[model samples]
Target: MPAEGVELTPSPQILTKTEILRLANLFLSSGVTKIRLTGGEPTVRKDIEDICLELSNLKGLRTLSMTTNGIALTRKLPRLKDCGLTSLNISVDTLVPAKFEFMTKRRGHEKVMNSINAAIDLGFNPVKVNCVVMRGFNDDGICDFVELTRDKPIDIRFIEFMPFDGNVWNVKKLVPYSEMLDTVMKQFPSLKRDQDHPTDTAKNFTIDGHEGRVSFITSMTEHFCAGCNRLRLLADGNFKVCLFGPSELAVSMAEYGSGSCLLLD
Candidate 1:
C-alpha cells in the first residue's frame, strides 16, 4: 500500500452485486469457468459474503477463488467458505514480521499468519500463499516459505515482481523464476518436478516428504501468454484482458450489454 494512499472510487461508480452477477453469468456462458475475486483486499467489502454466494451459485462457474492480503480473513474465511469460496491465495511476502511491516506499511503480520492457519483448519486443502519475491528484500525468505509446507498442505508460490503503476518497479529488484528455483534446489536437491496443467501459470515442484508443494509464477522471465486463460474485471466494470499487456483494448461493461460483451472477442 502506498503511504499517501490512493484516491477512492465512489460507491455508485463501482459495480453493484447485481451488475457483477450479470457480468459473471455472461463470462460463465462464454466458457469462463473460473472467477477469482482479487483486490486491493477483497475482504474489506461489507457485502463480500453475499458476492461470494451469488458468484459461487452461478451456473458454469467451477471455482470462486480470491487473492487477499489475509488481514481480515480469519473472521471472514468461515463465512466466505460457507458462501462457497472454493480456493484462496493469501499474499504474505515475508516471514519476518518487521520486514512485512516495512513492505506493506502496516502491522498485520500476525493477522495474515492467523488467516493462513484459519484457512487450513477450515479444510481449505493446499491453501496457496503468494509471495512476491524481490531481490535484497524478502527473496532471502524463500526457503522459510517452503518450510511452511513441511507438514501443512500449503502451496507456497513465489511470484516474480512485475512492473505495475505506482509500484516503482525496477529491474534490479526483480528475482527471476530460474534463480528462485536454483536457490530452492541447492537447499533441497531432492525436489521433484510436478506436472502442471496446460494453462497453469506457475511451474510446480514437490519435496519428497513435505505435505505441501512449491511453485513459481514466472511472469517476468517465462511468459505464459500463449496458454494464458485469465481475464480481469475492474471494480468499475472495465474488462482488463491482460495483466501485463497493454490495456488499450479494455472494454467497459457499462457501454455494452451481455450479448455485445460476449461478442467482443
Candidate 2:
C-alpha cells in the first residue's frame, strides 16, 4: 500500500461474481487447471465465499487458492476451506509488529499472525507465507521468518523485491536471491536442496531436523520468464499477461454485462 494510498476504482467498474466466473470458466476450458484468487486482498470482498464456492466447483479447475493479507482471514479460513479453497499464500513482509504497521500503514500484525495459525490448524497443505525481502527494509528478518518453519509444516517463501507500479523502486533496496540464500546458509549450514516443480519460481530448500521448508523467489536476479506460466486478471477486468509486463487486453464486464462478446473467440 502506498503512503498516499491507492485510488479505489468505482464499484460499478469492478467485475461482479458472475463476470469473474465467466472469465475463469473460459480460462479453465482453455486448459488452465490452477486458479488463485489474488488481490489487493481477496478477503475484502463481501461475496468472497460465494465466489470461492462457485469457482471450486468449476470443472477442470484443479486448485482454488487465494493470496491474502490475512487481516480478516482467521475467522474466514474455516469457512473458506469448507467452501473448497485448496491452498493459501499469506503475505507478511515483516515479523516485527512496528515494521509491519509501517510497511502496510495499518495495525493488523496480531490479526495476521492469528490468520497464519488458523490456516495451519485447518490443514491447508503447504501453507506458504510470502515475505518480500527488501535490503534496508525487512532483509534482516529473513532468518526470523525462516525460524517460522523450524517446527511447523509451513513453507516460508522469501521473495526478492522487484520493481512494480507505485512506490520507489531502487536497485539498492532489492535483495537478490543469492544474497538471501547465503544469509540463510550462514545460520543453518545444514541447509539442503529440495526438489521444486519444473515451473516453480522459488528455489526450495530444507534444513536438517526442521519440519518446515523455505524457498526463495528469485524474480529479480534470476528471471523465470521462460518457465513462467501465470496471468493476472485485475479487479477492474484488465488482463495482464505478466506482472511486470504491460496489460495485453482490457475487458469491462461491467459494460459488456457478462456477455461472451467481450471474450476472445
Tens digits of per-residue lDDT, candidate 2, 1-265, equal 7787889989998989998899888777666788888878888899999998998899887788888999999998999999999988999999999999888899999999999999989998679999999888899899999898998878999998877777688899998888999999999999988887777878899999888899999888898878777767788878765677755567553332221111111
- Scored by TM-score, the top model is 1
Give candidates' CA RMSD values in order.
Answer: 3.4, 4.4
Residue 129 in candidate 1 has what lDDT? Answer: 97
Q: How many angstroms is residue 80 displaced in model 1 relative to the true structure, after the best TM-score fit?
A: 0.5
Model 1 C-alpha lDDT per residue in residues 1-265, reported as the tens digit of each score: 6677889889898888898889888777767788888877788889999999998898987778888999988998999999999998999999999999999999999999999999999999889999999999998999999988999999999999999878889999999999999999999888888888888889999998999999999999998888776766788777666787657344654443332112111
TM-score for every candidate vs. truth? 0.93, 0.92
What's the true lDDT of residue 155 in model 2? 93
Candidate closest to the true structure, highest lDDT: 1
Worst 10 residues of 1 by lDDT: 256-265
Model 2 residue 92 lDDT score:
94
Question: CA lDDT, every prediction?
Answer: 0.86, 0.84
lDDT accuracy of residue 234 in candidate 2: 80
Question: What value does the lDDT take at residue 44 in candidate 2?
Answer: 87
